[model samples]
Target: MCLRGSLHGPSRCGRNEGRDLSLDQPLLRIERLTKRFGGVLALNDVSFSVRKGDVVGLIGPNGSGKTTLFHCITGFLEPDPPSHVEVMGESIKGKGPDGIALMGIVRTFQELRVFRRLSVIENLLMSAQQYQEDKIVPRFLNTGVIRAHEARAKERARELLELLNLSSSAGKTAGSLSFGQRKLLSLASALMPDPQLILLDEPVAAVNPVLIDKIKEFILDMKCAGKTFLLIEHNMGVVLDICDRIVVLDHGERIAEGAPQVIRTDPRVIDAYFGT
Candidate 1:
């Protein structure tokens, strides 16, 4: 039996009452993850795990390899040999972006990836089509089976739009929506696949306080529905409120990791952020 709400707080599946997450294996794990860009060492032996149902926060200063870590994990960049990344206990070191995503991991970029010319719903439909079905014959033939699949995809898009409170903007051009709305749309698009673990890169960046709250609400709702997340956010307040455990990186190396409370008062964290 694992203790609840200790100084380190609960582990993965932390929010569940009286449940020990220790017996369960991690959903994602990395071992000695190292990345280098020519002469610059972007990441050196960084490691962490996001267990099932865990909302883990990844925080670091600028150029701390936080985004690079995300890229490596999602197959955007290859890590050096002997560096291992695993999803559900299987190695994903050499897998490409689509392959990793199909393996149940999806990520949202800090920079929005919405289609400017596409309608809000169209963008989501595109995401669904790309991942949900990849058969060339069904796509080009547009047979009854393919049409039914598309119908289901559109239905799922509507459901996601309603969930994210964007139902009214379904027909609007994605570029015409407010910046905050675009962010929400991007998040909805990422969810079109119903991915198991969603990696958010600064989900609340540049948004108003009201919109930030909405994003937070969406995350909490999904979490309650058994979705897991690994978030990279600079907003300390949001990180503290939403994450069960926080991991801090500085200069491309993991410097600290613990519950929010532990991270708040950590000496190394203060020094890293403040340079004191």
Candidate 2:
């Protein structure tokens, strides 16, 4: 059994053991993605590919376009023309955020986006509301399909709560939880949709050390279960520990892309972070 079983339950263990990680096509491809805001160019021709079942880290200085690139990919902001963001070989260029999310892509914000007044479980359930069948007639009739969907969503929410060590606080308001716990809640909310690719913005920032470790464990467990992640993180230790590859951005362009060891010693990365 996976070590995570003790904390995440046996049902979650070994689900992806021997799962193929070598898919021919990249799960997500960003080609010449650029974003401009009036007089400022936020992201200038950034490009990268995230493979199936891999965790890729996006790291750079504060204004290096990491979050801007995420915004462009997830549809919060449109990329300039001639730029393409593809998932499973299909272009999602003009799709809205909802469209992109339904395409099996979901993102979490750097700031906490949880409903402050809602309970932990409620927040998660709300995140899955987009997947519910909401036809007026069906909703009015309380159709079996809708009930079953609600049940499944609740089940998944509880499972994620346990996985993140937030089950004990399931009934508490999101605003009442500690900062670290709230961070975990945001992650749980992101997973509610069972997305193929999860974009996490500063997932571990400002989180306590213990919770940071817990978050890292949860991410590794999820990756082992065949999930792909593109994350923006400044914690190099966490990045090096969890990511299969690192992409370094500087001044809105990719300056380095390689394994963790290579990124750690790359002269360009060194200069970008430490100056000449």
Q: In order, what lDDT does every prediction score?
A: 0.85, 0.84
Worst 10 residues of 1 by lDDT: 1-10
TM-score of 1: 0.91
- Give RMSD (Å) of candidate 2 vs. truth: 3.7
TM-score of 2: 0.90
lDDT tens digits by residue: candidate 2, 166-193:
8899999999999899999999888887
In candidate 1, clashing pairs total 0
- Backbone Cα, N, C clashes tallied per candidate: 0, 0
Any idea what lDDT model 2 has?
Answer: 0.84
Instruction: Give the C-alpha miss distance for residue 173 in model 2, angstroms.
Output: 1.0
Alpha-carbon runs more than 4 Å astray in model 1: 1-18, 138-142, 274-276
